[model samples]
Target: MTLSLTELAACFEGVIPSILCTVGADGTPNISYLSHVTRLDDEHVGLSDQFFSKTARNIRENPRAALLVVNPHDGAQYRLDLQYCETVGSGPVFERMAADLRATSAQVGMTDVMRLRGVAIHRVLGLRAVRSPLAAAPPEAWRGSALPRMAAVVDAFADRTELGEIVDAALDALEAAFRHGATMILLHDPARDCFVTLGSRGYGRTGIGADVLPGEGLIGLSGKEGRAIRVSDASRLRRFGAAVEASSEQENRTRSVALPSLPGAMSQIALPMATQGRIRGVLFLESPKRLAFSAEDEAALALIARQLAAAIALSEADAAEAAPDAPIPRRPSEVASPHIRVVHHAHDDSVFIEHDYLIKGVPGRILIHMLEAFLSAGQVDFSNREIRTDRALRLPGLKDNLETRLLLLRRRLEDKNAPIRLLRLSRGRIRLHVAGYPIVISDRKSGAQ
Candidate 1:
């Protein structure tokens, strides 16, 4: 009997690199390695097009292709007879596959070299399980482990009044109940167009306050594309060029260091926290073992992401209501020290403090505005609503995540050991602390139009 595609779902998740066999127009067989085969449905799978020039050429010339996939759980093999149908150069499928491929390439030190040209969709005409003497029994499909208590755990999220409590509870449940090790939650910073690490579990340091640009690393790409990325052997891909491109090496050595990845990570999954067609952040989990997470784990995390997204939205709204209109009393300023020059490059939104890179983009603009406001009016405390309405910030017309941007900016300033600092007074109100450093702002001219 022919096997249903659902029966071989595990093999399609890129647990084991799939082997694709295609015939050239001249009829010579060509084989290529496929890192990602996303299941569109029972009859279709999407393959990421990267380093598949020959495979693409052959498949277009000869529509028939064969794929061999192995189940990571039990080493069982499956063969799929597929027909090359079409290629998607854009949209959700392309973005998802590209993000996965980018993460896969980063693990193997080919980050900058690999680029996803498109996603090739194939029609699976036949699927057959390969009988192997070495095959082992599959792991138990359902573990009454966290599934039973998941409903209660998810419901508890709505009860969380504070964002910190919600984050802590979610991470706590993932570790104590779901058995996830090394997990982190990164909130989105629309102003900066990046994901900033908020909290983490199972790492030596929280890596909190670290910012990752979307489409840079695995976490960044997931957040950027609003997709989930899972890699079985994460350490094997180490190019990390996209991540490094965010900061200058000289700056990392002398000034604030660059953000880091999860320590001792072997396998990892980055899932975007999205709900109501809005992306809030990204959820990342890592482990030191290969194939550490399964489809079930992914499903569970997706549910959690949904719950967290709604909770976060509600919390932010509540915080906005509670925020005060006027700035809090400014703390006594210390004696003014030497002049500190803050340069704002309007071209890229890059900000430099005394030639040391502080932050760029929305956060930089926010800092500039704040410093200007302080210089003009001595304003200290501020609220998310105030920043969101600031005409000078020029925040995107879309739903602005002003709060997360503030968090990212605060963390970055702390990392740089700048004379000015921001303190969170409440969910929405923040108190700014400025040392006696006289601040000077410069608007640098840009070459770009």
Candidate 2:
């Protein structure tokens, strides 16, 4: 039976490294391990050009080459006879391979070492499966159409009116429908130039308010490039949590939250939530099993991310269009017995509740504004429109993204289990629920509260 290149899908996932054999003009054969092998089409494949000087030299001298790839699912092997084609330094194929390499290398702290110079395209002349003595194992039960489950997840987004609910639904759907237990949603903060974790699941700590700079890691790189990035096997990479613990501690000293991670995650994918060219956030998932996410999974998740981005944008617009509610008289707190110390650091707009870091940047500024209003006028309710138009807030012009900021602030407060809370009363209105009498302190210098 003739086997098509499509039948070797598992081999292209990079779960197991491939081997390339090439011959020089002198007829000397050279063999090397390949970090990536991308199936451009049924007859074409693209190999990453990194740390392959000898392979490159041989490929130039001899166009004929052989590639051996193994199936990560059942240890099946296939050898492909290839003819070297042109190398691409830039293009869709090159960019895709570069992104994947960057993501994988970043996982292993080899971002500088594993730089992609170009992609060597090759034509598949023939394919031959290696004979094995043992019988092949049956495919896993979960190996089937993901369309139905993907549809259900997309449908789950239909009725979510609030940004918070939408974010939660995305994470929950990933678990319920896709069986991806470890997931997180980090929203982009343009002013701060970073992504902040607003929602997460299946982690020991929520890692809410965690900050990831653009191009920092898999999540950041996906957001920076506005594309999906998947690393099928990260077993050799240093555990992200352990590698960054010291840095996280130092960042925490300056009020930065540590990123959440699964200790032994073997596979990871970061899908960008984007709409109309602007990235809104990132949908990140990781697993303990290698090759947990496939090409189809990435495509499906990309669609879901787009839907989520659009939904978030629509929700924000709807909130912005809401008519201002009639002014309500001040309502005094029923019980203001205990006092909670709220400190606002003017330098970075970081807010802390009784010395516990809560949040910073736009969300922090918004919280301080709300707390100040409550302190002065006993005002429990506020309107989004007023917040957006408030010159003191100095929110970004025209694209304030007030709704998302409020959602972040609300979630952070709840995550911290702080004394203050922001409850959405309607599309444009919210009420501040303070459990204790608040003493607001504003500091101009960078110092401990």
- By lDDT, who's the top model here? 2
Output the lDDT of residue 234, model 2.
80
Evaluated against the true structure, the overall lDDT of model 2 is 0.84
| TM-score, per-candidate, Cα-based | 0.69, 0.93
Cα lDDT tens digits for candidate 1, 279-393: 9988888777766777777777777887888887777677667777675566544447666777777765667777677766677788878877777677777877788777878
Q: Write the per-residue lDDT of candidate 2 for residues 99-169, one digit (tens) a residue.
A: 88888777777878887889999999999998889877766667677787789888987798878888888
Off by over 4 Å in 1: 1-5, 18-68, 78-157, 162-169, 203-214, 239-257, 325-357, 365-379, 384-398, 413-420, 434-449
lDDT of 2 at 308: 89
